[model samples]
Target: MRHPLAHALRWSAVGVLTAGLMCTGLTASAVAAPGSPPDPALSTPGLPPPAPASPPAPASTTADGLALTPPMGFNNWNSTHCRAEFNETMVEGIADLLVAKGLKDAGYRYVNLDDCWALPERDADGRLVPDPVRFPHGIKAVADYVHGKGLKLGIYTSAGTKTCDTAGFPGALGHESSDARQFADWGVDYLKYDNCNNQGQDARQRYTAMRDALRATGRPIVYSICEWGQNRPWEWAPALGQLWRTTGDIGDSWGSMLSILKKNLPLAAYAGPGHWNDPDMLEVGNGGMTDTEYRTHFSMWSMMAAPLLVGSDLRKGSQATFDILGNREVIAVDQDPLGRQGTVVSSSGGRWVVVKPMKDGSRVVALFNETGGAQRIATDASALGLPGTAGYTLRDLWQHRGYNTAGTVAATVPAHGTVLLRVTADRRWAAHPPAVEPGLDGDPLAVAGRTVPLTSTAADLGRTTARQVSVSLSGPEGWTVRAASPRTARALRTGRTLRTSWELSAPPGTPTGSYGLTLRVDYRAPSGVRADSTLPVTATVVVPPPPGESFLSDLPWVSAANGFGPAERDRSNGESAAGDGHPLTVGGTVYAKGLGVHAESELAYYTGGACDRVTADVGVDDEKGGHGTVAFEILADGRRAAGTGVLTNTMPAAPLSADVSGAHVVRLVVTDGGDGIDSDHADWADARLRCRSAS
Candidate 1:
């Protein structure tokens, strides 16, 4: 699917290193309009906007309104499986516990079923029939059982052709409208739409298709888009979903838990009241995590405003799990009606501090030490800006206690633990204080050989999007112009020299190379305001080697792989040609990740000499639920020599196969399609298809 957004950056050229000032503007959308009043409707006490509008009804009951504070719920996938004591009996038992134990009274309403609920095939009429063997009473009966208990019931499905379980149920695409109707008929309230087999389509189409499908049901199921983090969903998924997955599946291990939390901190702004950045599900009540890690997990997730989807055996939950889940003070932060995701204010090694600006004009601060040792936490009076002659109210969220504090508060946080302090006004304030000007430091930007620095200032501006600044420049003789980081068409040309112009957008992955263009300041303020200022710029370009030398020849691997080294025969050319060098020739296996391929093909090497010894170790995880395949092939002396296989257990796992000559190649082909051979266990380790000179 072609994204509506084609331009990521643009650049122009001016003469030499330094260029004069030009007009620049920051549009209204780029910057928040000055002094806009806060929207009261946006901060609900706990409920957030529904995922997005779908048939039946949009996931949200309110229209773009802020969410009610926190959401509490239990999901089954974390502990339940197709095998091992999971049946209608288990479901009923868990459901009974949810009500009898006061979890529902504690604000957890949804009893969400994860995967493996469907039968191996749809009914003859194309309607998905529940696996009668698993749930003898059917899904509707289960829904009623939960609904009678005053709790909502949630179900799951995939956007692809098959469920992640590789079971033969239909998907949302082509079947979206139908499946949605089915879910609605089943009285489903929350739809956890997953991405299993839908690899060929772009995120926009895949997500939007299901969004529309769910809406078509007229059932008002919450739309949850599960695409991992490809295409930066947080930037656009809100249009299609209420919540979007932000990372790979999280396990119930301390390392897995911490890694996921740290990865999401930089994306704090993407989360808000109605829309949330989901970090998979909560694993706190699950057994793999320690009590300390579980507490930290709940604390961090709540601070992050992440949807609290508890993934554990609630019936068997320990007292610690209940305490962690039932902490109303901590839940207040997670359910903070303001919906503001906490942001990192300070960090050092294993200890860090974060602050969430509350709608009540106060701040919620968390001092976290995720290590095995205790750390002292101190809040500077200057940083908090507490006025003299007035005391502030400090509420300990975890301890559920309130007190008065003046200047600063000090506490020692235990290892792998947190101290959450909700600082609010002791008495109702007349009005919020003026916005403070944030501090910023400027640096010299080089263009060509000139420098421009010591000039920019950063201040507080309420805007959803960041601002971009550019410079225009002219060049000297013989320097026609090479390229720009932000490719732009507007260039200032004069005589034999060309002026260079620049524009900054979101950064890309390629190393930010220094372009040889004169630089100037084109200020685009967050508020549609435009200005021009003089700034310095410099240039850094890597000069190519002499005529006789080739870039690839510089690597020692070139000699090690032999002149008979690896090289590609053909490429699928199925997607964009962004950073990849076409006609890939590998003296060795140039293995890079994130290929974004939609079809099956090969990455092969060709050497004139008859060669073999082709081996590969395949690591596969079923994130979307359906099976993924990887194949190894060996080509020697212009003929196929050997091949091997790796497949999924649920589906037939296909082995690696190839047919080429010694002079042809050795390769790896990964795809969504195959002959369906070894589909049961989709994993292979160092599986090699070796064909050497059979001298």
Candidate 2:
């Protein structure tokens, strides 16, 4: 069977680019400059003439051929990102953590080092050498150390005359053969060859040069081609490298990850046991995205059969990161011997359904919620390419739960969350009761006027097929439920199932809160038994909080919470972040902590400051978090007024006032001090604004 990503949205259809690819905003650092001043990343001091290239070695026969499966391990690029921490010590720390954290037993074997590992110049023998300050023990020592711990080692280099980083590290331009031998001599098991300042060389020829070089070394190293998909490597990447990057570098943000995922979702055919599509590294513990978003990141990468190279400070990782990285069921999907990459099968209302076939003939189905709000995403077995309407037994991979599906399956996916399950055909026979799971594919969280999708997966277990099955959602007064179910029941095939939907809308008058919701599935089984009277499962309907007060206050305050950088309000550090969405709150207080563990919060929008002057008491939200120091500020137009220099722990509210005369908006900015943003939930307590005069 053709893989979905490879055969769909092929390069021929997208009009492959020459050398430049539109990266949108997420690819700020993905491109390489033309022959300009030697990028610091590309320059290396001169050295003695190099020795002759070595002869090609005989082919080897390793048990699991190189990259027969997506490589599981950690890389230093994203997590450290030129932080000066990409060193031997860092690699040693991670190598230790991988063993201590049981990652080794979980199949995470490689410990890769990215760029900036070399000295400013090559050795007298014309060979690359480790920076003495960062790797005093030498490259071979680190490789030996990693190997001593039962893990493989990977390294990075560029195909051009220079590297991509600002430091301009040396490249393999004229020394591919020698460099390959050098890596093999040092026990390098993998190589990430990048595209940077290649002197305008043809990518295919340049990559091929290195590929043949590595092959000649006789080392079973995994060759990773990082060309940012500019030349559409998928068209010819299988022979170039074990894996090839399909897009530019991935930033540690929701938007960046989503953009990369969307770009790679359609190219599954080019991936298999010995070759894969690389989408950069994992950002699970990078503190750039939320825990929920990280889950989506891991799920999508696994489903795509991409390398699971984590790029975080594993030594300092949190439990959430550990769970995501150590998820065995998810890992199994990525390491499936069949090596088939999953592809998007269906999409509706911003929800996507991805399915990958397993070695045992089972299918891994993922319901991804792409919108900022929660959603109901559902898919039928037929849509997943099932031969018949067999009722499938579904196993929630993350939650570790097992249940029988109603022939079709649905899940309520949270914003940036996924419902991943392993589905196997269920042919067991049953008689008597019909069943339905309500609200099966939507989040309990919703906004007024926005459709809160709900699903009912109905089942007919008896020998006789039900003539008709009715499914509907029980609505609140004045709330309308529109359901679409099958008028006539399908035949009672053993594994076949039925699914129906109900989209409910919260009335404009509905207040912000949670309400009860129930769904019913009534059907007559093939044995003439009625299940319409059975009780249905119930879920909650959460209406979102809108603007408190009209045209003046029509828009909810927009917020920018987290990214490793400073919040826009951080005048002291010249740091800024941005997001154009309503703030999230709990218990009537805006939980203004931004993304990641150390986040920033800037809540601002058009506000006449009610009467042209806004006053409020600001402090840390005592109810949500009790730790961390947060600086609070009030700004009107461009003028800064009252502010709380810094508040730590459960503290008293400090008065804040902003003059809004002739101003159109006021902003509340909170910055977590150098201590980081863990538990830095700031509150704009008792805020009040004066309206503009109608005079």
Q: Estimate each model's TM-score.
A: 0.53, 0.63
For model 1, how does the per-residue alpha-carbon lDDT over 1-695 read when each residue is reduced to its tens digit?
00101111111121001000000111111111112221222211112222222212234423634234445677776566345455666777777887777777777777777667788678888888787887889999998988898888888777666655423355565777788888899998888876655545665787787778777877767776766554566767767777877654564445445545765665676676667778778887766555766888888898888888788887789989888887867777787778878877666545677777777767788878754334555564346544443545566677664544443544556546777877765452112221111111211122223222222222211111123444344333433333243422222111111223233221223232333333333433334444333222222222212222122222111101100012211221112222222322122222232122221222333322333344433323232134333343344432446554433323332334334334432333332223211111112222333344322
lDDT of 1 at 83: 50
lDDT of 2 by residue, 492-512 (tens): 343345676667787776665
- Relative to the true structure, how large is the alpha-carbon lDDT of every model? 0.50, 0.63
Best by TM-score: 2
Whole-structure CA lDDT of model 1: 0.50
Model 2: CA > 4 A from native: 1-64, 426-695
Query: Candidate 2 versus the native: TM-score?
Result: 0.63
Top candidate on lDDT is 2
* lDDT (Cα, 0-100) at 4 in candidate 1: 9
